[model samples]
Structure formats: C-alpha cells, structure tokens
Target chain A: MNNDYYSKSYMPGIIKWGKITMLLGITLCFLPALVISFVYGYMPPAAAILTGLLSQVSVSGAFYIVEPISYFPILGIPGTYLTFLSGNTSNMRVPCSSVAQEAADVEFGTEQGSIISTIGIAVSVMVGLVILTVGAVGGNAIVGMMPAGMKEALNYLLPALFGAVFGQFAISRPKLAAVAAVIAIGMTWLLRNGFLDFMPGKNPPSYLVILIAVFGSIFAGRLIYKKELQVPEEEKTEAK
Target chain B: METGKKYLEMANSPLMWIAAGIAVFVVLMQSVIFFRKSLKAAPEVGLTKKQVKMAIQSSAISSIGPSIVILVTMISLLVTMGAPVSWMRLSFIGSVNYEAMAAGFGAQAMGTDLQHLTPIAFSCGLWTMILGSLGWLIFTLLFADKMNKVNHLLSKGNERMVPIISAGAMLGAFANLAAGNFFTETNSLTIGSAPSLACVFGCGIMMVLTKVAKTKNIQWLKEWSFAIAMFSGMFVGYLAR
Candidate 1:
C-alpha cells in the first residue's frame, strides 16, 4: 500500500504547477491596483508608496521569514502551498491537517500522512471559501443578527482554540509539553520586560521569542528522545 | 476619468469582478486539483473511504466557527472596499486583521482615510494589501520544495527524528501563540485576563474530555473534543467578563 510514486512522480508536478498557479494568482492579485491606477492616471507617489510599505513591512517583515519556517514541519509540502495561499494557517489548516492524520491513523512525515493532510486542508479551504462568500454576499445582516453576547464571545474563540490545540499535544506528551511551556513562558516574560530589546529593532522582539522557543523546544525534544528511545548502535546494526 | 462617486463605482465594477474572479478561480482550481489528487492517492496511503469521509466531515465542521469570525471581518471590509476586492483579498492570502490594516495604511499613504477613500486611495490601498502579503507567498513559492532539505538536515536522515522535530515545532509554535494570549501585559493600568481564562478553560475541558473518552470509549466525544473545549472556554470567558 506504500505509494512511493507520490513522492517520486506526482509531487514534482504538484510543486511545478503549484508555483505556476501561485505566481499567476499573485500577479492577478496585483492586477487590480495596476489597472485602477492606469485607468485613472492616479498612481501613488513613490515616497508615499515606500512609506506605506516600510511601515507595514517593518511590523510584519520578520513574520514573513519566521512563519514559513516555523510552520514548515507542520504543513509539509502540498499543505504549505495551499495553506499559505488560503492563509489562516495556525487556526485552520494546521488543525485540519492534524485531524486528518489522526483520523487516518497515519504518522506525520509519511506519504500517507501527507495525502490525508492535503485532503484535510483542501476541504477546510473550500469550506472556508464557501462560508466567506456567503457572508460577503449576504452582507452584514447575518452578522448583525448574531446575539450580542455571542459576538462578544468571539473574542475568546482564538485563545480557546490555541489552548485546545496545546492541550491536545500536551496530553499526548507531557514532558515535551513541559519543556515548551517553560521556554515560552520564560522567554515571553523576558521579552515583555524588554530584556531582549537591546538585540535589535522594536521594544519586545516578539519574533525572536517564538524562534527561540521553537528551536529550544525542538532541542529539548531531541534530547529527551535520544536519551529515552534511541536504540543502541550495535542493536541497530544487527537489526539492519 | 471617473472621479468622486463614479470612481467608487469602479471598485465593484464588472472589470474588477472579472479580475478578482480570475484570482479566486485559480485558488479554487488548486484546491480542487489537490483534493482530487489526494482522493485518488488515498487507497495507496491506507486511507479507507470511511476515514477520508470522517476526516472531511470533521474538518468541515470544525472550520465553521473560525470561518464565522473571518466572515464577520469580511463584512466590515466590504463596506469600504466593495465586494470584489474584499472578497478576493480575504479569499487569497489576506487574513481579516492584516487586510484591514493594509487597507488602512494604503488609504493613509494616499493622504486620506479608509472611510472617505478616493479612487487613488482605494487603488493604493489595494496595492498595499497585495504587497503586504507577498512575502509569505513568495517564500513558499521559492522554498516549499526546498524545505524538505530542512527536514532531512534536521533529522540527519533519521525517520524517527522527523516526527519528534515536527512535534517540537508544533508545540513550540502553538505555545508561543497561546502564551501571548495567556500572558498579556500585566501592570498597574489594566488587566487582560479574559483571554488567559479562556485558554485555561479550553485546556481544562480538553484534559477532562480526554479522560472521559478514554474511560467511556465515546467515539463522538473524542471527535468533538477540541470543538467542545473551545466553545466551552469561550462561554466561560464571556461569563468571566
């Protein structure tokens, strides 16, 4: 049942076509501005444009580097393209991919795992699109109809969601969970106090905190795994 | 050239719709193509039809709550930007908050506000939105296939190390995100514990559900564990407020 062909044959084409479609898609996204500016002859001044980009990118530019790398292990390849294209990685795509892998009883990083994860992400994206489309078409009437209390409660949903995800992982692996919590909390505390402000830009250095926590936690997991589960070299050689 | 209200008309014009529609169509095509490929490859991967169906249902149902929040954001964006740009941006790489912020910046750059955007303001706003998100897409496009090398290098070609590293990455990323919510600025001015309480409630409910599922073997309980935890946490958080 192992279809190595997916990796051998299918994945390269998927990547190739994915890049083409994505490039076209990205280009189309910018088309509106180009067309509008040309038609109206109202192109924004270069300084103003640079100012806007500088402000936006200064805030989010680090994320562009960190997020894709941080999320790579979770989303894998096909899921990577789809998740970035669709956005909402942490809240939707990652969870969906995890659920699919769990339901399919496949290990992550495996071919089967990748397939199931891809399907899960696609379904999530399609559903999200449908819901958004409906909301857009229906306008605010639908949102206005929601109870005031429920709308207020929506603020807490993401925290709850993040907590639930963390809990799931924690329940499965308490030791690693402990390691992550310690690093996250300690680093967050330090960053909040401006302990790392001297490093570079900004007061908090939030991206650095996340990166440290991620890599630190990974190191901890590897340390624990090697001490705990690694087979003896002689036994491994014999088995091979 | 169209100016004033006439300029605004272009925001939702047929030309804009057609262009935005093409972008959305490309996204849709990718999703459909990937979905079909996965389904075709499912049997080879040991996925039963039932498992795939359950996965689909679980993910679809799970997404509704989050999607509702996004839809609400879209509604707000649509007021200023019109349907076509709002729909396309939100459907593409744009998240709710980021899109609004980008639009706002775009408007500001044009020396206007989002509410009273001229055609030029709207156009630049669109540009900012497009450029703001290109980093993620560009990174993915250039490096997605190459990232396999990262996995390999990290694992040093050890298959077992792969999952450990993945788990570490997942846990660390989620922890940092949750930590921000749980541990907000706590000083003399104000306290923001609602998010933290919601998070604790979510974790608590999940732990309890895991216990119950293990003890009772309630299949549905396991399936709905995360959703239940999340909603319950939200309710508690609301009450706490």
Candidate 2:
C-alpha cells in the first residue's frame, strides 16, 4: 500500500504544485514593497534599508530554518507548503491540521494523514483570509465596540491554544507528554533567569528551548518505547 | 514633501491597495488550488467522502477563535501601518508579532519611529517587513521536498516510527509554547496569572471533553471540543483578572 501510494504519482504531482505556488508566493511578497518604493517614488536610503533588514534578520534568521524543520513532521509536504506561504503555522495551521486528522480518524505521518492535513490547512487559509478581509474593512469599529473584559481575554488566546492542543495530544501518550513538558518548562526557567544570556542579545534566542524540547523528547520517546515502536513484518503486511 | 499625515495618505492610496490586492489574491488562489487537489486525491488514500466533509467542517469551525485573535491584531496593525500594507502583510507570510517589530525596526533605522513617520521612513519600514519574511519562503523552497530524506533518516528505515516521531515533536513544540507563557519579563513565577491560569483551564477542559467524547461516542462534542475549551479558558482567565 505504501509503495502504491507513492508510485501512483499523487505525491510527486503535489510536490511540483507546491513548489510552483511557493515561487509565486515569493514573487508576490515583493509586490507592495516594489509598488510603494518605485511607483510612489519614495525609495528609502540604501543604508537605512540595510540597517532595517539586518535588525529584523538578527531576530528571525534562526527561525527561518528552525520552524520549517520542526513543523514538517506534523504538517507533511503539501501542508508545509500551504502553511509557510499562508503564515500562522502554530497558532492556526497546525491546530487545524491536528483536529482534521483526529476528526477523520487518520494516523499522523501517514499518506492519509497528509491528505487530511492538506485539506484542513487549505480550509484554514481560506477562512483566515476571509476573516482578515472583513476585519480590515470594519475592524476598527468592531474592536472599539468590544467589551474591555473580552479584549483582555484575547491576550490569553495563545497560551490557551497551546495548552488545549497539548492536552488534545497528551491524552494518547501521557508519559511522553510529561517528559516533554518538564524539559520545556525547565528551559523556560533557564531563559528567564538569564542563564542563557551567553548566547546572544539581552536574552538567548527562544528557538533554543524549542530545539532542545523537540529533540530531547524524541530521544526520550525512542529509549522508553523502543519495543512498542517496532512494527512486526506480518502486521505491516496485514495492514496493507 | 509633507511628512506625518501625508505618509499615511500614500500608504492608504489606491495604488497601494492594488498592490496589496495582488498579494492577497495569490494567497487565495493557492489555497483554493491546494484544497481542490487534496479533496480529489482523498479517495485514493482510502478516505471516505464523509470523512473529507467532516475534516473541512471541523477545520473551518476550529479556525474562528484564532481568526478573531488575528483580526484584533489586524486592527492594531492598520493603525500603525495603514490598511493596505496591514491587510497584505497579515494575509501573507506575516505574523502579528513579527510584522509590528519589523515595521518598527525599519522606521527606527531611518531615525524616526512609526508614529513620527516620513515618506522615506515608511518606505524603509516596508522594505524591512518584506525582507524579514523572505528567509522562510526561500528556505522552504529549497528544502521542503528534501525533508523527506531527513524524516527517513530519523526513523531509521522503520516506517512505523514516523508517527511516534511526529507526536513527540508536537508535544515538545506545544510544551515550549505553553510554558513560555508562564514567565514574563516582569514576573518570574506567574502560575496564577491570567494567561497561565487560562492555560491550566484550557488543558483541564480539554481533558474532560476528550474523555467524555470518547467514552460516550459523542461525535459532535469531539468536533467542537477545541473551541469550547479555548473560549471557556479565555472566559475563566478574564474573570480571574
């Protein structure tokens, strides 16, 4: 079944389409900048542009590599393409994908899982764009009318989201979840105490905590569940 | 040239809207194409039509709360960056935190802030925001297809290990994100803080929802669990504060 799925040309075709869309996305990324700078004749000084670029890069340069790699296992190929292009990976895309897979009863990291995640991510991108468009048109008035308490609650959205997603996944693997949480919280404590100040900037780069936690849990999972993780050849064939 | 108000006028000009519209159009087109392709291919992967419908419905419903959060951020971005650029950036490869910081850096590089803006400084801010996000696109373009090899190597030729690896990564990533919220610059141990309490509440609610949904075979409850958990947590946090 695995061979049949890959050899059927669906995977390769999606990859090709993904690359094309991403290239188009890259070119489109420059449209607003190009139009404003050239057509409007408000070009910035070269030095200022360089200074601005460098400062932004200093903060986000590491994330460029770290985020895509870290997210690929969960997102798969087409979902990865849709996600990086659409933005809001962790907050929007990943959660959508996870929920879709669960709803469909698909196993993560499988071909079916990837297809379901792709559908989920695509739906999110469309829904998000529509909401953003509406918000752009009349958001100021809506925001002004919102109650103060609700506005304050919005501040906790990210934490609540992360916690809920963690809980969703943790129900299946309590041991691995506990181990991962300990490592992550410990890293956060170290970051807060200035122990990681030796790295760069006033604080260490935040991705370090993510890197340690992800790989650390993977290593721990392997050691703790080596036997269970191994698939018998007969069962594999039977599954097919 | 006049500076303060005129800069915003230019930022919100018709030409700026056209340019921003092009970017947003590209994003929409990509999503539509990918969605169609995946839905077509679903049956070959052994997914039922009913399952596909459920996936789409659940994901769309799941997106509402987060999209509202993004909408609030969009309002703030519109105030600082003007409607055109704010709409384009938020629709494309930009996040709420990154867009604000990049725009600030660009303005600062020109020796002015976002508030006291000049045309040139505005252009610089635009340039900075554009350039800051290019790295992710470029890196993904070069490496996304090749990542399959990395996955294979990680699994050491055991296909079954892939699911385990994926789960571990998800757990690890969420753990980092949730834990990060518990510590702020001003407060070290903020366990009882609104955001931290929200996290606790969200987790607790989800655990109960999932257990009930699974044991009782409540299909609709399973689908709506995330939104219910998230909003309940937010409400509890609001009341606590």
Candidate 3:
C-alpha cells in the first residue's frame, strides 16, 4: 500500500512483459519478409536493403525518439507499452487515452490516470483490430459501396478529431491552452515558411517541430502556474 | 512475371496469414493482459469499476471513426502488398503514409515502383518496412521503463506539478497537430476557407457540448461530446469544400 509500491512492484513486471512482447512483435513483423525471400529464391541484395533503409530511416528515425518522449507525460507506463506496440500514437492513442482520463475524472500523471489510460488504450486497440479485420475480410466491397462525398468527409475527420481533443483539454485550462495553441501554430507557420529549416542540408522534420512545441508549452505552463498563483506551499501540494 | 505472381501468392498464402495471425494475436494478448492488470489495480488506485468500464466504453466508441480510416488504408495496401503483409504492417507501427512510403522506398531501392512489384523489389521493400519500425521498437523497449524519470525530473518531486506538466504536454502536442490541420496556405480566409474550418467547428461544438453537459448534468453528452464534435466538424469541412 505504500506510494511507490505500484512503481516498484507493478511497473517492473509490466516493463518485463513489455520488452518480451515488443521484441516478439518486432520479430513477427519480419516474418513476412523472411518468408517472401525464401519462397522467391531471391534474397534482396544487402545494398538494396540498405538503400531502402537509408531513404526511409533518415526521415522517420527521429520520430522514434521524439514521439516516445513527447508522448510519455500523457501516456504513462502501461499505456506507453501498449500504445507503442498497437501503433496510432497521435491520431488514436493520445486522444483515446486523454478522453478516458477525463471521463474517469482522474488527474493526469497519477496512478489512477495511468490505469484509466491503459484501459482506454487497450479497448481502442481491440476495437481498431476488429474494424481493420472487418475491412480486410470485406476488402473493396465495403469501401466501394460508400459514396464519394462521405469518403471525402472521412478524410477530413482527423483535423476535426484533433480540434475536439484540443478543445476537450483547453476548456479546463484556457490560458495554458491558448499558449499551447499559439506556440503550435506559430512554430508550424515558421516550419512552413522555412524559418526553422536551419539544418545544413536537411529540412527540419515535423516531429522536431512537435517536440519543440511540447517542451516550449511545458516551460510556459510551468511559468504561468508558478507566477500566476502565489499560494502557500501546502496549497500547491494538492496531489489528488 | 511468374515469379512476381508466385510471390504475391505466397505473400497471401496460409503460412503468411498464419504468421500475421500470430503476430496480431500477440498484440491482442498484450492489450488483454494490460487491461486485466489495470482492472486489478484500479481499486487500489482509487478508481471504481464503473469508472473503468465507462472509460473502456468511451474509448471504444472514440476508436470507431479513426479505425475506419485505418481500415480504408488497409484495403488500399492489401491490393498491392497482399493481405498478410498489409495486415501485419498496418497493425504494426507505421501509418498508411509511412507504410506506403517505406514500401515504395523498398521498391525504389531496386529501381522500381510498387505498381508491379517484382520478387526482389518486394523483398527489399519488406526489409525496408521491417527496418523502418525497429527504431521505435528498440527505443521503447530500452527506454520505456526509464521514462518515469521524465515525470520526476519535470515535477521536481512535487506531486501537484505532475498533472500540470502532463496537461501542458498533452495540450502542446495536440495543439501542434490541430494547428497544422486548421491553418494552411489559402488565398482568402472565410468560414469555409481552409481545413481550419474543421478545427473551428470541432472546438466550437465541444465547447457548446461541455457547457450543456455541465448545466444539464447530462453525463452521456459529456461522454459522446468528442464523437459529436468530430462528426460535426467533418460535416462542416465537407460542406465547406
């Protein structure tokens, strides 16, 4: 029942299992590649594989670092493991986890919030799996039946989802929300305008822009929380 | 050409499906295990059964729209990559664009395109796809357990600051995402000028829904607010276009 018991006992087990499952998942991801190479009697030249990796990894490799770190504060322990493996971190997992935390009335970054987020993420993964499986099984017939306008509408739903998510949180902390929005939009503008493309040869990746916004807003929030409210030490220690 | 057709056949063969099935099964197990563990831990963490169930229900509902997008992407990939590979990669780390690009790069490495994927090109593409995700998997496996340090470092041992930092981070990340969609290069700004319209509609709808839920104490409205906002935003976006 101690405060750190979950962190001490529960987390290690989760991490251990997380490593195993993730490693297995990664290996399984390679199974198709291995099977194809073997069946076709044609091992792709190492140079070709390297060339492909060079093209793709140079772009996305940074996100492996930026996304996990940027998303860590909200995702917490178990949510991180499951969300990473199940994919859809930004579009699906982040929003789903945050909504679950909000609906449960749990403060984010606490034990309760983490549990609720895990539950939310797990459910999302299951539901996503079901939806994808149905799509795969039905193939083109299902999507083929939909009207063009509806499909186009579906394409635009993500921005709406993002807005909904931002609004849901912003309602609670308007000032910090405004700061975050402004910083995000401003930074994006800079990115679009080539203001932040200072790298010698490479354009600034979008993930780095996201990372900057995440940390920038966090710094701003800390300042506002500390300066705007000059309360007693005990009052500021409201953990629950 | 026979080799190419045979590769596609093998890619969709029972073995490949079985492999993809096992991989998906492993991911599903991770979710189940985590869900069960969280349920067992909920009471200790001051969460009620009702709260957890509601969280699950809301998340499941929230997933419907986005999962439809994923499904659409999968159908597109399936035509080219075959069912087994398409199912595995999409259910893995990358998005539709990422997977498509990785596969395309893989093809291009062999001086070809994804249109008529030769066996060698397909193999190279498959390798590229696998390698593309390794960075995330490796980083997470190595660093996820240690990420708690981030909270501790950010909060400086103050519990009150924890939630604030988390909220700030969440706001920052989502704000960046939403801002990109909301703001684009447009000659003129109007109610329906750009994709920003969706952001406006989504946020506006959410704000209204939150107000009504609070004033009326209609709990279900609060739960469904996100879905409503998203759909309405999409509708507004459609009309604008």
Off by over 4 Å in 2: A1-7, A231-240
- Model 1's CAPRI class is medium
Sort the candidates on lDDT, descending order: 2, 3, 1
What global local distance difference test value does model 1 have? 0.79
TM-scores, all models, native as reference: 0.91, 0.95, 0.93
lDDT assessment of candidate 2: 0.84
Tens-digit per-residue lDDT, B55-146, candidate 2 = 89889989999998988998988877889899889888998889999999999999988888788888899999998898998988888888
Give the Å shift of residue B202 in candidate 1. Answer: 1.7
Question: For candidate 3, lDDT tens digit of each residue in A81-143?
Answer: 888898888889988998787666677777888889999999999998888887776888989
Clashing pairs in 3: none
Instruction: State the DockQ of every prediction.
Output: 0.59, 0.69, 0.67
Q: What is the C-alpha RMSD of each candidate to the true structure, in Å?
A: 3.7, 2.7, 2.7
Q: What is the Å distance of residue A198 in model 1 from its true position?
A: 2.6
Instruction: Put down candidate 1 lDDT per residue, B125-184, tens digits, no spaces.
Output: 888888888998898889988998988887888776887787888889888888876564
lDDT winner between 1 and 2, please give it.
Answer: 2
User: By lDDT, who's the top model here?
Assistant: 2
Span of ten consecutive residues with least summed lDDT in model 3 chain A: A231-240
